[model samples]
Structures are given as structure tokens and as C-alpha cells.
Target: MTQAVTVRRDGDTFQARLFWWHAARLLDPGSPIIRVGFENGPKSFDDIWVEYDPKRSAQDQYGAPLRREHVQCKWHVSPDTYGYSHLIDPEFINANTRSLLQRARDAQLAYAPDGIGVRFKLLTNWRLDRADPLRQMIGTRSGAIRLERLYGSATDNSKAGAVRKAWRDHLGLDEEELRVLARTLAFGEATDTLDGLRDNLDVLFAYVGLRRIPRNESAFPYDDVVFQWMAQDRLEFDRKSFPAICDRDGLLGQGEGRRHVYGVKSFEHPIDRLEERCHQVLDLIPAFDERYIRSEADWGDALYPALRAFLLSAARDQSKLRLALDAHATLAFAAGSVLNIKSGRHVELEQRTTGERIWAADDFPPDVNWASLEAEVVELDPQRPDLAIAVSLTHDIAPDVRRYLSATVPTVGRLLMLTPSTGPGAQSVACGRHAFELAEAATRMVREARGSSPVAAVHLFVAAPNGFTFFLGQRQPVLGPVRLYEFDFEGGRDRSYTPSLTLPISTRTGDPV
Candidate 1:
């Protein structure tokens, strides 16, 4: 929950720049090489370090530029080295999902000059059932408007109409049915729940992305995201191949000679659940028969982009160079072309380390005494306001967490949390040994609402081989030999071994100290 940095109007467009935990590429290599983690919390935008040419003065392709713009790195973990667990708020996740999908749409043609855009708004997600004004404020339309005023896009109404129309035609649904679907879409709910087709569902038609394709290469804007959806699932035609849809149902998997099989379930491994569900539902759709067997995607492979961002962030903060190795990112960099910009030279990048690409490898900040960070436990909730009054020690909260927590409580501004690294091959000490109240709460809600195993998503958020993240509702109080709060998200465990122990290895190689 990040408050948009600020807003400034430029001509017809109200110009504003905001920072999000997006999986971006470094400017130097220009390719999908290194992950550019936009930092949040305590660290100032300029202060945030990006391990690049440092010498390469690249343009920050932000929407609107203003004097002294800002960025904050929210909670993060190293994705390359190890596996981790995180607690996220389900309500927030639901809202976040809608926002992400909508943003993905808005940014579809973000790179296109005067590109046509589509804005799917979140009119309401707030619970009037809650009594708090602050929470209400967070979930209000005014808040959404404020956010939009600062970050909204100028979507092309005509384009949205065309895409919506194309999708309906591809599905062979009449205008009346299309209107019904459109109404449900207006509510900002997951389209998967459009018809409550969750149980005993049948094969269906869908699109990998929007109906329109870029006329030229300049539309690098939508290419990355749209292609990603394609890579996630194979394309198929309905009787007539007039157009293509994402095919969320196993309809394609049931069709003979069809090349791609889209996903219906959320599980990450064995594809057993998906396999079973596809079989059960295929018969429901009269057109799809049992003989239709297309290749099933691993499904988990699609999350790699987001995982790259998490991995890079964790590596940088935790000081573990190895986690970088775990992500194909180094490979993306190593194999991708690099830009010298000056002489137009391309340099190949190689991985230098990876002492331990495991889940739970080492500790970070070997010098920072964990005992001091581990203090008495202090819990916070919507009911308690004076939790700040009981505060004694002021461990500096990392800049990123500070911003996110600031959105939670006023006290967050006053407290300094002892922070740690987000490297791989280790666990985040945040919720000591995993009974994270906030994380577990989110997991339960996700399981109940999604009717899918929370373990797959949870592992995706905390584990490697995929992108994983948790909400970690504003941190809780810490107590014991190792402060609970200190460990919460700190890369101490992973970074200590990687950073402190491996530094000498590089020095021994006689590389520049």
C-alpha cells in the first residue's frame, strides 16, 4: 500500500511519477538483463543503488518528470539463492491483483508514442462493514481518484470498445451476454469469477492478451507483457481461427492437433490438479472431447519475470551475489547484448559467484549483532493506537519497509527497525520460524477464496524457481534473544554467509578490491 509520491499537471495530462515494485530491466544492457528494483521505504530514490555501469547516464523512463521525484523499495527478498515464506493480507491481495491486472493493461502500450490505452478502474473494494475511517480512506473512491489523478493513464475509449467487442466475437457470445460480462468486469472482480463458473466448470474461450497486435516494433510497450501471457499458455482457435483468446479453460487441451494448453487451476507442480480438473470439465463442454490432448505448460514458468525482480532485490540488499546466479537473469545478461552507448560496443557479462544456491544458506550483516535487534515483542492492530507509546529502542526500519508500514500506522514514522538482507538460499527472519500472523492470515483467506492450495502461491512468494512475495501486514512487536521484528524480512541469515564469507573469495582472485 504505497501512497503515490506526488502529482504535477503537465498540459492535458496531470504529470506525476510513482515507484512500484515492478520487475524492470537495467538501462545499461538495455536487454532483460539485470532487474531494476524501484526501492521504497527509508531509502531515498537517488540513494538507491542499481548495480550497472553507474557510468552509463541512462534516461529514467518515468511517466512524468518533476524536480526531485521519489521512489521507495517495499518489502523484498533475494530470489536467486533460496526459498522463503511470506504473509500477505488477502483483502489487500485481492485489491492488489485487480490493480496489477489493470496496470498491466494501462501499460500495455506504455512505450508507444501517443499509444491508445484502456483504463479499468477499481470503483470500490472497501468494506463498509469496517468502522475505521483510515481503512475507509484507504479503500475509498476519493483515494482511488487521488491515486489516479497522480498515476492514471489516458486510455482510448474506442480501443477498449474494440478489444471488448473482439473478445466477445471470439467467444461467439451475443451482444446481450457480452453486456452481462461487461457489467461484471466493471466491478473490478477477477473475470474468473464472472459467472461463478468455479465449480463443475466447462471448456471456454479466452485470449492470451488483448485482441490487437502492434503494427510495428515501437510498441515494445505491450510486447513484453502480452508475449508473457502467450508464453504462459498456448493459443487456440474456436472452430474458425478468426482470432485468438487466452483459453483459460482446458478447451484447447481437449482438442486434437491443438498446440497450446492454457491453465484452469493455480497449482504450481505436477499439474495433477490442473490435469484432474481439465478432465472433469472438458466433458461439460460438448465440443471438447477426451481425445484432445495438447501439451500442458509447466504453468510456473510464467512467473519468472516477477521472480527476477525479487531475486535481484534480495541479492543487492542481502549482499549475496549467489542468488543472482540462481535467476536466469545473469544468463539473460550474459547472453543478451550490452550497449556501450559511447562506442556502440556490446560487452558480455558473466556470473562471478554462487557459493550456495540453496534454500536457507547464510546470514547477512555478520557484523550487526542480532541480539540487540531481538527485543521484547510488541503487537499492533487496528484497535491499538498507543502501541507507539510503549516504544523504547529505535531500530531504523529500512527505507522501503518504512514507506509501506507508514501506510499502516503513524508510529511507523517514529520507529527505526533494524533491517537485513533479502538474498537467496535463506529464510527471511521476519516471522521467526514461519507462524507469521499476517502472512498466515493472508494465506488462509487466499485458500478459502481461491479454493486453491495456498502452498503453491505461498511457495511462489517465498520460494525460488518462481516469484514470491507477502504482505507482512505492518510488522509486529519483537522479543527474545533474536528480536522477532529484526528477523522479519532481514536477509541476516542468507546474506551473512554470502556477503561476509564470499568477499574474500573475490579478493583472493585479485579482482579490484
Candidate 2:
């Protein structure tokens, strides 16, 4: 499985956090801090010296991005229970809550009653990338606030040695006792005592195997990715988020398959509100709202059972639908997509060499105007074809066979092209003698679609290497292959062109280059 570590952004780089999975394994739920402990997860969870180091961002070449090797992490939750700052620092406090909610949702979403025992589970993973650096950082980082967050008062035995001794002396009774001691370690006005003990397997976690969480990127905020991965096979990931309590609709699955999510709250609330939040969390996925995936009436019957369960609960002050869309994994070796479309083959293009046989459209020049639309319908009164308006298109070809056809394609046709996000955004080397002619073609497509045509709107599409910047003239036009397409909104017409070369994209998204 591809390793992933959960992280929250601290200024520029992400600060590692302890998530639900670690808390479930390390903390006992019955402890006094359970509500706050699980609710805060790592955000408020204090840090003891974890044996992990951060990977800094840097750069070498001039003007190249520089990855900083280190930055003082100021976000560690304060160890002072009395520290008035955490309650005051809105950002930190909200972050603490958000982190907890994310994990809680993860736990609940992944819950399996048939499992052997009951325990909160954080369904995530990480990697060995920081293995070496973590060890080295730990060596020089001794005596630093072990738990970055607040813990019990340090004993005089020595800040480092004392904390260890305190646990060693009173706690380490047995495997079971270890769990209790871990939970009870929290300090508050009232204190709880540890009791049970079990086998302490003959082993050592000399390395706590604790690393700060990693910050993963998302495309459509949250919900968009859900559907993109679920309804649409556009993007794939190893794991994704889900919520614990799902309403009847079961939309949280991202339409891909069953997913797990967690639900968290500091205080009790009503069920409808909870259900609303559940939908709200789901709203964060792919299409924003359920309606985006399916029509309301179409999904009405399917969602009835789930809605009834929630409505009844609400009537009795019992309806509670946890908005628990936790992350899930759709991870696997999905095929690589075509990035750019230049006139060339794939194998030799990886290294960006001219060795691959690349030919422009001119190399296989056709005297005939490929822009003819005699077979295509334009004006439509109900799938009626739009006017097959003729346009004066002209272009010169390059020695490499590059040719730009400047003819205006009728908007009332289907425009087939690869998604721009999937490939490089490119423009053909051609000029329109009269740009208005091309604009008129677009107008016609829209008009036909409006005239009772089945097609609703004319879609204008374009492909760009990096996403388009509107200020920089980047358009949202459906980014597809190398070609740009403008078509009638209502008319079902076709306007496709030959592809050129392809570009390379990193497994990680949002890369500019």
C-alpha cells in the first residue's frame, strides 16, 4: 500500500499530528480525557518527545523552489493545562477540533461491529521516508518538551527521566495496565487511578514509530474528489475518508464502495442536526451536494428509508445522523493517462527527445477542408441541427507537419477531446483571418441548443498543462486534449481533431511544471 501520513499545515510545512488510529491504540477510551482526548485527537493532544523529524522544503537552482530543512514548530499544543492561550488562539483551537472531528469521523466510518474487540480505529498510513532523519533529530532533541502538548507536572526526578520513571514505576504493570496508564496519564482537577494489567509482550518500541501527520492535497476541496473517485474514474487514491453514521442514502460511499468515517462532538446534539452535518460532510466531497450525483426525484425513493430513520429519531429527540465522511483509499496502480498530445509516440517522449517520429498535420496534408459540416445538422427545434454555417479557415503547415486549421467549427456538434487536467493545454499554430467568424460559429451552437434542442448548453473546452489562471487568460473551458473545442449547447454535433504529443504528470497533483 502507498504510505500516507496525516498532517496539518503549520504556516508553510505541515506539523505532524497524532490521529484517531494512534489514540485508539494508545489511549483508553474510558479515561476522563476520553471526551476531550478523542475530541482533540492530536490537535490538543500534548506531545511527548516523539521520535520523528520533519522533511523540509528546499531548492537548489536559481529561482527554484527551496525546501526548508527545518522550521520551529510553534503549533504543538501547550503542556500547560492552565495555558489560557489555546482557548484564546482561535486558529489553533479550531485546528484541534477539526483534526479530532476528522479522525472521529474516520473511526466511526470504518467501524465494524463484527470485529473482535471494541476500539477506536484511525484508518490511515505513512512511510519510511523520514526514518533516518527522525532518528538523528531525536538524538539532538532530547529533553525538549517530550509531549509538545501539556501533560502532568514534571517530577523533580528530571524532566526527561522523571516522566519516564513515573510511567515505569507506577504504570508498566502489564499489557492491560499499560492501556489504562496511558489514558490516566492526563492531569486535571480530579485524577483517576490505574488498575488492570496484562502481558507485556517481550518487545521494545525503542522507536515509538511515531511521526507527525502528513498534509495531503485535494482537488475539489473534499466532496468533488469523492465523486471523482467514485462516480467518475478520473482520479484514484489508496485511501479516502468516510463518516461513521450514515443516513439511509449511503451517499458517503463516494459511489465507489463502502467507506469508513468518524463523527466527533464535544457535547451531545440532536439527530437531525447530526444528520445534516453528515450530509454537510458529504457535501464536502466531489459534486458538493447529493443532487450533483443524481436528480432529487430519481434518488427520492432510494433515500426514503435512510431519511425516515433520521426523521423518526429527530421527532423523539433521537434522530442523529453523524456527518461522518472520513477518508477512504481507492489506491492502486491505476494506468497513467496521456498528459500532452504532440505529434509523436509515447516511449521515446519521456526523455523529451526529438528521436520519436513526430509529424504535423501538414506532413499528411489533405487538400480537402477538414472543417466541412455537410453531414452535421446545426439548427434544431428538438434535436434539430443548427445551421451548417461555412467559414473561411486558412493555415500554413510547418516542416514538422504542424498545421493550424483556423476554420470556425459549428457549435451544434459534439466536440471530442481529452480532459485538459489529464493532458497538456496546447494551441495549434494557426490564425483566423476573421476572429468574428469563429465567434459566430460559437453563437450558432448556443442558438441551436436553445431552440428546443436536446443539448442544453454549448460547452467550450480547452486543455492546458497547468490548470488555467483566469487572470493569466486560463479558461475553465473543459480542458481536454491538445485541441480547443467550442460547440452548440443544444445540438448534438461532433467536432474533434487529431492529437499531437503527450506530457508527463507527477503522481502528486497540482504540479505546475
Question: What number of clashing residue pairs does each candidate have, in the order they appear?
Answer: 62, 115
Q: Alpha-carbon error at 82 in model 2, in Å?
A: 42
Candidate 1 overall lDDT versus native: 0.21
Could you give candidate 2's per-residue lDDT for residues 281-312 as a string of tens digits? Answer: 11112211211213333222323222223323
Give candidate 2 misplaced runs (Cα > 4 Å). 1-117, 120-300, 304-513
Model 2, backbone clash pairs (residues 3+ apart or across chains), number: 115
Model 1 misplacement above 4 A: 1-160, 168-173, 177-397, 404-408, 413-513
Each candidate's TM vs. the true structure?
Answer: 0.18, 0.18
